[model samples]
Target chain A: MNYEAIVIGSSAGGLSALKSIIYNLPGNFSTPIIITQHVSSLSESYMAVFLNQLSQLVIKEADAGEKIKPGHVYIAPPNFHLLIEEDFTLNLTVDEKVNYSRPSIDILFETAALAFKRKLIGIILTGANNDGSNGIKQIKHFGGHTIAQLPASAEVPIMPQSAIDTGCVDKILSLEEITGYIISICH
Target chain B: MHLPDQLNNIQNIELTHFFELIFNVYGYDFRNYNKAHVKRRILNRINNLGLKSISELQHKVLHEEGFFDLILRDLSINVTEMYREPGFYKSLRNEIIPILRTYPYIKVWHAGCATGEEVYSFAILLQEEGLYDRSQIYATDFNPIVLETAKKAIYPVSKIKEYTLNYQKSGGKNSFSDYYVARYESVIFNQSLKKNIVFAEHNLVTDGVFAEVNLIICRNVLIYFNKELQNKVTGLFTESLIKGGYLGLGSKENLMFTDVFDQYQVVDAKEKIYKKTIFSSK
Candidate 1:
């Protein structure tokens, strides 16, 4: 699959899960990875900083109007919903929170689906809320690939379980398997 | 994942036509707005109203008397709060306020000041710094309904606690509770705070320069515009600001890639504050 972009959603026990996945990816990875990990609206991008130190991929908090590029991991900034424009530039909004979460996983996945369509891959990771459930459905509806972390293997299985329950997910893999699969399919 | 690419392209064409119809009939120019944002809002409206497509919505917009007004509200993303990004306000106090004090009379244009929370926040900051009497704030938004709410200056009482916390974080001098009168379910800002503010309906996309002010605080508004519109609006800001005036953008927004990059020097990088340099290029 010639994927152009990958949209990820995580919450609850997401930091370690993200660290495991992002650290294994090589510096030359071509797919631009965009992630939304649920955090407090008042929090900073310390998570990005911490993950960047452990990852080969260039990782940073996404800035509005920044262009999507290969080998860069963009984490959605705290307190703002991150969106991908059709031109591949990022946009941030302070619109009313959906499912009580700003930087809502669904918002990112749905927008990316519209932008990249069949060339996109949507992944749902560890989370307690059902924020990414509808997003996975939207991605499937838009003809984008969908993957959910294996609920049993997740730190907090509720999020991935909800996403799987949507009946739209294509694959459910453990953290290690998921990382290997992404590297395999992306190349 | 086998859907044809034409699905999105068809929706895109319909959306462009819908925006053109809106501009030609109502004069609210959203043609330059970010496509994803506009589409999401329009799609949400469609889902709620049980409409099929943008074409169906367009037909109702043309014939229905009050339908367009609802669409206008749907298009306007009015998510705002007092002291949004408290660090920006803190920077305003430590970095920008001292410079503002150098001037005898300060003029501030709060462009895209939706609901005027930040405008009042600025007014409060000026008051604390003893510059309120010498300041004039022009608070402008394209939406008249929001402008009306700005004039009323009332917000839900539930939000006061959050505002108070932001005030403290922003280095507020006095008790935040002192600034407002709490009614049953709402808090009305003190009448005195609004004395220096002039709320008006001025569209940034269509409106011309109304004043050459010392400061312009337009936060979180430019993210809705595409790159071309963003550059054009930043140019408008550059032209409206006096030499050496300050322009505070949303924390994520910057002028580094814009055409006006060379015209301003960085004041505070973390807060996205920039000061216009003398000797304009354009």
Candidate 2:
């Protein structure tokens, strides 16, 4: 399926996995990528700066009301939620903590499912909790594609295992292979 | 059945039933709330309603329409005061006021405002800062009954003594008694305080954004939502805040773990007041 946006949710041991997936993408890659990585609220913008340094894509923390652009990666800032609007702009809210997380994977995936519909692709990666399972279900219900990191290959298997157990995931791939799979599906 | 065990069992059963009923009938998702708190509140409601069992209270709630209103009050928190955590209000007055003063017209969303006390407190603060003339406050709560109570702006005169102390602690420049008149057992707040305030029913759980705003105050509400709901509401706030706008949470609430933390900088870290960053607009 062709997709305009790609959303990824990750928790423990996500950095290396994310590095492998993102490093493979060319700087000119046109799809808008949004990610939620568990981090402390007091955390700085190091992740965005680090990702930008590692990958060719323009990486930055998502801002409220900022328009989404192609070939850039938007990371949810620590402690707040990042939602995509139908108009392809970013909205930030301080509503509540979901799944005991502020930048909850569920919030990112669920809102993306609502706003992007079939044009969205949701990826659930390593984590301890079943945070991404319900979100994956919502994306599938919205006719969007869903993928999970292979439990065996994930740093923490519970999150991916949970998503896989939901029987909604369209793909379960190793971290190294995820980028190619994403490219293939988006094309 | 023994009373304690019966109440315990009834609490569990009624809570599950209430969760299912609210989800099915109203489509307001409360399934993932903190289970312990939800159960306690449910049990409290049963006792407050003077029902023998949770099942009996459940029956009343299901059969009688207005009973749900009382049930909602039991479920939703309404323990807010005018200047809760006086230090936070102090920070708002000192730090946030100057920023708000820059704008000619300001729109503020008081999400999850329970019983309107905090909304009036904010209105009063705006008045003191001379910003009330240009500000419009949209005070919203999920509980309609509470919204009505908020609109009335009436409270027990007994609570005013405590609230007056809070007002003074929060740097109020005027007499707290000057803002309200005591009639019988009730204190009627000045009507002018609510002139620019609009009280409405808005469920942060299921509602959409309320457009551009200069500041969004959603204190003490996030502690009740499960992580997923918390994130959802946070997203709503993020969507509603204008670039460089201010977002304030309960003193205990911090943006540390959410995806939007990097989007703001703590204006007063101790008070949980944050200023939206320019980079947030990206």
Predicted structure with the largest lDDT when compared to the true one? 1
Off by over 4 Å in 1: B1-4
Give candidate 2's chain B TM-score.
Answer: 0.90
Tens-place lDDT digits, model 2, residues B1-282:
544334345556667777888778766668866554455456657667687766787688678877777767667867677787788899999898988898999999999898899999989999988989899999998988789999999999988977998899899999888899999999999999988998888888877986789999998787666567777778788888988999988855667657778888989987899888877853
Tens digits of per-residue lDDT for model 1, B1-282: 323467567778999999999999999999999888889998888889998778899999999999888998888868899999999999999999998999999999999988888899999999999999999999999999889999999999999989999999999999999999999999999999999999999999988898999999999988888789989999999999999999999988888988899999999999999999987674
Candidate 2 residue B258 Cα shift, in angstroms, is: 1.8
lDDT of 1 by residue, A103-143 (tens): 99999998998888888999999989899999899889878
Q: Quality of candidate 2's docking, in CAPRI categories? A: incorrect
lDDT (Cα) of model 1 = 0.92
Q: Which number leads on TM-score? A: 1
Model 2 residue B181 CA deviation in Å: 1.8
Regions more than 4 Å wrong, model 2 = A1-187, B1-14, B47-57
